[model samples]
Target: MHIPDGLLSMPMIIITYAITIMGIVYSLRKLKNFPEDKIPLLGLFAAGVFAAQMVNFPIIGGVSGHLLGATLVAILLGPYAAILVMTAVLIIQTLLFGDGGITAMGANILNMGIVGASLGYATYSKLKDMNEVIAIGFASWLSVVVGATLTAIEIGLSKSLPFMKVLTLMIGYHVIIGIGEAILTLFIIKAVKTKLPEIGGVPA
Candidate 1:
């Protein structure tokens, strides 16, 4: 769920803005150049990601689910590019799709792109040191949970919802939704991992 402006207090926005700026700068600095031909692929992938977010799957009645694809992107592209792609997706969602608001851009970026892509990527790397498949699933699931849980917390803190009730709902739904996310991420990574060495730092 993308949050619009006027939904959060000013202090919350300021904190998110600071965190988002740091993430953007870090991602940019860490960017590794790929082949010239590969540049277009990343842009195209970002567009696809933006579109994917539009189609939300209904979980129960009101709650919806969708692909973060953060783990998938991090697996194939690496954290730098994946974070860039994800951040771009959220930006476009705010400007073009109006899924989020311009004022709330920083918050969305922090929760969705930075947490989902960069943090998930780092977590994946740590666990992947043990098992590839397990790492893949865990990373994917956590990314979704982190974003959803944080969103709920933010909204609850805004007093739009009671904190405990909202927290329970967000986590409860994401637990089931994350299973699908984990399965989907694992399947995709497994299918292409052999062909793409960069998927998990394996040399091509």
Candidate 2:
């Protein structure tokens, strides 16, 4: 969920910026030598993430919510790249779309980019010994739900917006919507690994 400007306090905003900076630095280091062949794929994935996020699925009675697609990016490009892509999405939303506030950009990045990427990738790696596909699926699903849940908590904890309802709403919708994330991530990972043969050595 995008926390519009003036919703978060100063301290929270500052902390989020700090986290965003760390994430960006980490991503740049990891992507220092990104392969040229993946350029188109990267663009496609970014565009797909943007488009997918635009389509809100019905969550509550009359309310709907959108996805961050963080797990999808992590599954495809690894966690670091996923963070960078998510940051790009947040920037776009802030500058052009006005969907999220500029002050809360850092918070959004930390929520959707860092937390989502780190959780999804770390979970996948931890579960890798069992089954890659299942690991990815589970990790992707949990990452989105967890990411959104944490973000909602962050908002609720804020002095400016200490509303528990946000936590309930965000976590509620994201839990089910996360299934879509998990499935899509698994399917794409399987498809790419089967056809590409070199990406992450995933077996068809």
Candidate 3:
């Protein structure tokens, strides 16, 4: 979900911005020696996520659902590179298309890019050896839920709605939306495995 300006309290905005900036910086440092061969794949996934997120489905209280694609990117490229790819997509969406707010950009990136990629990667890495498809699907679903939960928390902290009410609604709606995410993630990962067998990180 892409949060708009004026939804979050100023302090929340400031704190999220600080944390997001630090995350971006740290992610950048981690990828300073990133391989050249993977650059095209990075750009490709960023474009895909940017396009997918453009079609937003309204949920409630200014939140929306769309394919995040962060889990797919993380599983393919690794989390640090996935962060940069997602950061690029969110920045372009916020700045060029106004898909998200300038003021709320940090929180948007934090929710979808950082949290989604990091957690999705962790889950997939832990379980892929057991069952690749299940790991991919579960991690993809969990990423969406986690991102929505974090957004709900931010909105609740801003006093935009009752915490429990919004939390329940956000989670409830996103749980279904996350199914779409899981399906798409599994499809893309499998496609990559079939077409680009030389690529690293993907389950064999």
Candidate 4:
């Protein structure tokens, strides 16, 4: 889902950069207000997310998929912190590993960090009270779908590809990927609740 440079048009790139900058700035302010003791946990979660993204599995038609870990991080560290964490991960991947494009960094951050984490967090928060497992699962799945949809739209708007074709292809493969995300998220949440107990106040 990491768009390479030259994939997005100038206008889309600028728009994404503007939105991403605002999200980063707001998240930094919110981070300053977070409890000091929880700072290390943020690092831990970031590291975990970074590591998880290292392994990409083949999907279909020669495409591949990897864990975004956006929803998972949001579940553990709220949307603001999750944004910061994802930003760091993406920067490292782009600059150090060349996984994502340097020019398209802002767009990637906007799609995965802002859209994925924020919407996923909101979804989980609203549904958790009803059923924790279901909430995490649903949020994890829905977040990926939403991100893919946005990516498709961006590509479509560029006039480089057919709108519905790109949309269908992206969403079709990601639907399976979303199931993996949901399962991984649920397992991790369950593990944290059983072992850490203090993290995220996961219900017993």
Candidate 5:
């Protein structure tokens, strides 16, 4: 979900920016040991996510939800790299497409990049040994829901909208969109595992 400008209060904006900046710094540090060869794959994932986010469907207020692809990227790359990749995508969208607002960019990155990647990666890693398909599907779905939830909380806390109403509506819409995310993630992961099995060591 992309939050536009003028929706969040000044305090919330500053807080989110502070948190997001810390996350970015930490992720960059982790990338210090990242495989240099994976750079292309990272770029590929970032580009794909950037393109996918182009098609957005409006939700209540100035928010809109779309195929985030954060979970999928997290699965292919590590969580740290996934965060960076999502950061790149979000920054590009904010600067080039204005898909998300400049002032609200921090919140967008916090919700979709940090939360989405970390949650998805944790969910998938825990369940993968049990059932790969289920893990991917559930992780993909959960990422979207959790990110939307965070967005709801941020917006609601800003007092721009009633906390319960926005939370309910955001969760409801994201639940449906998350299914699409799950299916797309499953399809892509499966295809990559079949065709380019060596790409990410994605389990078959």
Candidate 6:
């Protein structure tokens, strides 16, 4: 849900930029404490997530959806690192490819990078002790929904469309998209756990 330039009001843009900068700063501070050995995984995960986002599938009413992968990255690398990964991905998408608008990049990062990754990690951390797969699946699904909801609100605040209608449509399409996110997240986590066996000791 990348918002293009001119879609958001000036006030909203400024506010989002302020919030996103704070998140990035905080995330970078926390990232400094991450183990050195796990650093390489961040690049790999970011590359995979960037590649995954390129393939967008059609949803109802010609809307398109793709894997956000925030929950998956958060589960694998931790939430702080996930934010950095997502921020890097979004920056490249906006600058080089123009996949998302330059002016709206702040909102995009805040929605997917901060909100999606942070909430997903929190959810997974809370439920993982009880059931790993179920926790991952639910966290992946819910994070997408939450991101979509935030995007809908931002779009609605612009007054360019009806708030409730946009909210309903965004959430409706994202729910279907969330299933794919959940499945992919679970598969990747399971694969990593099987191969490495020592990394996080992900429960089967």
Per-candidate local distance difference test: 0.77, 0.77, 0.87, 0.85, 0.86, 0.86
**Number of the top lDDT candidate:** 3
Q: Give the C-alpha lDDT of model 4.
A: 0.85
Of candidates 6 and 2, the better by TM-score: 6
Candidate 1 per-residue lDDT over residues 27-119, each given as its tens digit: 777674544456676787687677767777777768778777866777677777777888888877888878887877888887777786777
Off by over 4 Å in 4: 60-62, 202-204
Any residue pairs clashing in model 3, and if so which?
none
The alpha-carbon deviation from the true structure for residue 147 of candidate 3, after best TM-score superposition, in angstroms, is 0.4
RMSD of each: 2.7, 2.9, 2.9, 2.3, 3.0, 2.4
Please give each candidate's TM-score: 0.86, 0.86, 0.92, 0.94, 0.92, 0.93
* Model 4 agreement with the true structure over 96-202: per-residue lDDT tens digits: 99976787898888877788788998899999999989999999899999998998887688667678889998899999888888988899878877887778542
The clash tally of candidate 1 reads 0
**Tens-digit lDDT track of model 5 for 142-163:** 9989998988988898875578
Local distance difference test, candidate 5? 0.86
RMSD (CA, Å), candidate 3 to true, equals 2.9
Give the Å shift of residue 93 in candidate 4. 0.4
**How well does model 1 score by local distance difference test?**
0.77
lDDT of 6 by residue, 1-204 (tens): 788887888888898889999999998988877887877878888999999899887767777788887778888888888889999999999999997788889999988888877899999999989998899999999998999899889878977777889999889989988888888889988998898675673221
Residue lDDT tens for model 2, 79-171: 777887888888898899997899999988888778878888888888889998788888888887887886786677676454677888787
Clashing pairs in 6: none
What is the number of backbone collisions in each predicted candidate, taken in the order shown?
0, 0, 0, 0, 0, 0
